[model samples]
Target: MNQQTNSEAKEFGSLLLDVGVYLLSSGASCSRIRITMRRLAIAYNYSPHISIAPKSISLALNDEADNALFSGMRTTPAQGVNFKTISGISRLSWNASENDLSVQQVRDELSRLIALPHYPRLVILLFVSVAGSAFCFTFGGTLLEMIITFGATFCGLFMRQEAIKHKFNPYICVYIGALVASLFAGAFVKAGLNINFEHAFATSVLYLIPGVPLINCFTDLIDGNILNGVVRGINALMFALAIALGLLSAMLIYNLK
Candidate 1:
């Protein structure tokens, strides 16, 4: 019975990891999946591995699914043994890893997701651009401020629709664009542009900071995975800082003009 339990625990751990990895590859933040999977591991009394790559996880899931579907095998999470259980894992697995592929492949997949019938991430992004701009124009502390910020954000986003079509590295592009785009924002500031460089720069950094990882770190903490959680939090904070510093430098330069 002890051996059986141990075996079961391992299987469930792997399944959970694979599923989580699939989700990460599909665009869910790494921190989100890491936190979620760690909890699942503890709940099932399984030892979980750290930082499984999304691509690797997705491929494993695909292989598992193909073997199960074609060979009449089913996965049973509760038992920790994959049998003909006919559970929802298969569908969930498919949904998670369907888009797992190379960088070029991911870009293609992203384009498809953006063009999907139900939800267009691009449209939402466009909205963010306009809303963000409106807020910069008018202080973001009020609804009116948001309107202006969002408007400018929208303009940046809309104006670059063609750029997105080129299938380039959007994260890097947006980060760089924010520097140039923010100059326009700085110009739009009310009170005759006497905004303090440091404060304005700090506040502007919130627009795209990777807050998800910080939240994910706490989630990991809740699951008692202190080391991994802390690491993820630190990494995320580093990225957030980079973004802030980049914005700050850009703002300082613009202020000199």
Candidate 2:
């Protein structure tokens, strides 16, 4: 390859890797990331080869006409779920493919999408807490149980968010959230609240469940990505174990039967 062609290949490979990394970190399934990146590559008149792993993604950009190839791998740690980002990037891929966008234009749009802010912290806390209460109610909890569950869920999630902001280990953060929530609900039980305190205690920590990871795990397996699926499955199990250990600690402290 000539100098200019080689440079162009490198640039494209880097950009494609960035896209794959962002998608993976944002909680897109392995298949989704591969499909999206392939779409983008074909749009730019290049062929793409991709391999996704739990903590990394590898991409290669090939130009058949010139027989030029550029390949690279990028680390893509779990960044937490952001469906908005996934959707935005999917749309961007289609737009790029249809409009034949320049590399710079695609880069600008990707930047804009990544820069978008999430919902307000308080807003998330409120809604998620409410959902916890709803779960309690669905399981035949009384009004008081629901109320206590709401408080426990709110406090727990707030602490989790704080811990995340402080860059604590993610599993440790889950444990902290579960501990705080269960403690709050367990306190009411220890106080002889004369209600179904068990219900509140059981449901308060439900918010800590890693629903997305579990779903993604199954999806990856069904899509024939066994390695990624197993990795995700193990990750989900760890989170569940964290929650269980935290709740168990609370039960031991409160001596709850």
Candidate 3:
């Protein structure tokens, strides 16, 4: 429990908090965060305890001899999904544990992972719109319906990305995206451009679905992280509500039955 050792424990605790928060906000399940943090702590010869909530993570680091302790908490970043980052961090944890990496080395790897760029915006927009069109086709939409769906989805997702870039409220962004999507599709429906307009309209906004959050909600509940599960479930419900409201607005505007 010397001063230097105590300070090191505190530093390690802070690092653990960083990792937990990053993982949680990036859409890792609560159980996954707990397991990852535990592995990293044990690798560095510290015992770890963590509390993961919907919006924050708390971690404690204790020396093997139980003579020094450090506790820290960090509010999670804005929620998003990045499977690449999650996989990278998971691999980093395994490497750190196997190679007995120093705390600084782990941090460096973490920094590099965080800095990794996502797919270009245009590529995402193109592929996501194509997926929406594919869903329209799968639902028996006509060729014209698929084309309209592609346009709607492209515009809708673009709006969402812009809203996120400007830091709009997440729910508002969903609503806006859905509104744009449904409105675009609904316009064509009203114009009598396609027989299967409903299919296109329905599928255009599929990109806005909170799939990751909804899946993680059940995973957390199954793993006995009830508090986190409930919070995530509620968040997913809000997104659904936003989408519904947005589509409703479009319906009203277009006077669609």
Candidate 4:
């Protein structure tokens, strides 16, 4: 009975961490969220992978830039609390039964959510409009293409918003952003609009900063978890590749005309 209860607690703690991750990524309104998980084990108190341990639910919120993923880790020993020896057979629980805190899980969930076609539909449409404006400018339709690009770029700031929402696959987002920018550039060029590709490209690419995961990877290495670090680095690299592919696809389509 006790073992089952502890197991349930760990699962619950994991869930809380997941939610915390989402809030942090969402850039909603947070400065930061502080969290701690407490558990007691019979033989061993913890594992490195679990975000929180049963005995110490008193940990503070860590930052993305800090690389605290595996860095600055310290083991909380089970014994000597209240003068009693602790065991490896652990029992775990949480303070708040309501808030979610599962960071990594939520990252994956957000990816799945954004991957849906509907989310990109409007974003893509706005991009097309910008492209048309550029096409007009190239062909001497109007000088207003510059104004259109400015407005479109401003609204697209939500790209950063999504990043905060824990869209770990930043490369895909960059690709889409590039596709939008390139569409405009190609259109302007094709239409003989007087516009600089460099400006459009620079304006839209700010959405590609995969900052948090990169920090996590660095932190993992600092914490002596090289394997975890390498894995995260690979994921970052793949995201970068996705961005490149998005750009390549857009360019290829542009050249076809």
Candidate 5:
């Protein structure tokens, strides 16, 4: 095996690992991350081994021609899925398989995909507010309750985004979101808004639920990824706890009982 060939194998291995870690941190299920990464390695004619954990991923690659081994690990940064980004990565993997693209070409394609823009802040806020209103309606809330819930959800999500912009701890941001939402609910009731107070209060905070983590917990469990499932479940529970604490504090302060 020539040194140049071995070096290229190592470089490809590292890049493959990076792609897998990005997917994992971006809220892709563990199974998907594993499958997509393995498929990419297979396309490149390399034997790939991967280990995924809650916060990190490790990968090893073996080059048959050079009889060389390359291994790398990347700690995943906290990131949420932009569906467009995930779709782009999926397409890139498919293209690499069908086209048998070289490592450099694959890297260029990945660079372009990764640069795709995310949804604007206003769009996210509007959608989340609508979702919160939907949840309230599904819970049999009155029209007035839904209106107050929408306003509370909007303001809560706005606070969350601001906190994120300032790089606050994520859990802290969740806490603030719940606090603001619940406080608004309390204020509406205090002002004698014609609403179902309990329903509005509960639904206002619904936007802060960690829906992805809760769904992924069951997914990982059913897939026999027990450790990851347990971890995700615990993370979801912590978020729920933070939300409860925040809402409780607000209720107490506003004499909402």
Candidate 6:
């Protein structure tokens, strides 16, 4: 029975580590990752120590004997936000804490949650176009410019998605998206489709802003996760730079000034 219990505990800790890695890779803040892992460990009668960095997560679990019974670390690539996955994992942690589910049972629930489908690609594209069009209107774009911005943003998002799907670097994808949007807006101006160049150009690339990363950077700092906060902040800055470079490149190429 002791051997069986130890085996179960080890399996539980390993699963918990995987959960932390998944959360980190899926864009959860460092504080959120640590808190969720600790909560899950408490639920399973283990003590957890978790560490999160920009690209990796480490978890160490202790059994009743206070021995380091399990330790795991994983490196994950940067991934786009998926609030559904984050919220599902949060609910799973809370449920596990409340219901006293066995390790295998928790694993099953986690698998089911992870399998939940994401929003369809078409829906995401529609939302992105709508957001860009809304920004254009807010920035004083004429109706023609707003319509053009919408179309440009839609096509730009498609290009960005294709680049990402083809395994291009994220920075390159952002640059490409910005370039596509700016060129489209510039072409419209050159062709006399719209004259309010400022509004069109400004709003055209707004969809590429790294809003989540910037927000998470501040949140991490406020929560005292300095290293992770700095990493996120730098990433946000790099993304902004890539976008600016792309926009400027488009302007020079198209002679938009």
TM-score per prediction, in order, is 0.49, 0.97, 0.97, 0.42, 0.95, 0.95
- Overall lDDT per candidate, in order of appearance: 0.46, 0.91, 0.89, 0.42, 0.86, 0.86
TM-score of 3: 0.97
- Alpha-carbon error at 111 in model 5, in Å? 2.1
Sort by lDDT, best first. Answer: 2, 3, 5, 6, 1, 4
Clashes of 6: 0
* Local accuracy of candidate 4 as per-residue lDDT tens digits, 108-200: 543443333333646744664565456445544445545545443444434534543565445555666556655554565567656555444
Over 2-21, each residue of candidate 5 has an lDDT whose tens digit, in order, gives: 78867887889888977887
lDDT of 1 by residue, 1-257 (tens): 35654444445544564455444433344455555555444443333444444133321211212322111112212211121111233333343345333323333443353333533767766656654544454543444444444544554444444445665554544455455445545655633644443334333434555555577667767776576567768867666655655566566875644
| Candidate 3: residue pairs that collide | none
Regions of model 4 farther than 4 Å from truth: 1-174
Per-residue lDDT value at 18 in model 4: 41
Clashes of 4: 39
Tell me the tens digit of each residue's lDDT in model 6 across 28-108: 888888889899998777888788878888888887567777787788745677777789889989988998887788788
Candidate 3, residues 49-168: lDDT per residue as tens digits?
788877898877777776438888899877579887899999999999999888899889998998889999999999999999999989988888889999999999999999999999
Best by lDDT: 2
Q: Where's the lowest-lDDT run of ten residues in candidate 1? A: 77-86
Worst 10 residues of 4 by lDDT: 83-92
RMSD (Å) of each candidate, 1 decimal: 11.5, 1.2, 1.1, 14.1, 1.5, 1.6
Superior candidate under TM-score, 1 versus 6: 6
Q: Supply the global lDDT for candidate 3.
A: 0.89
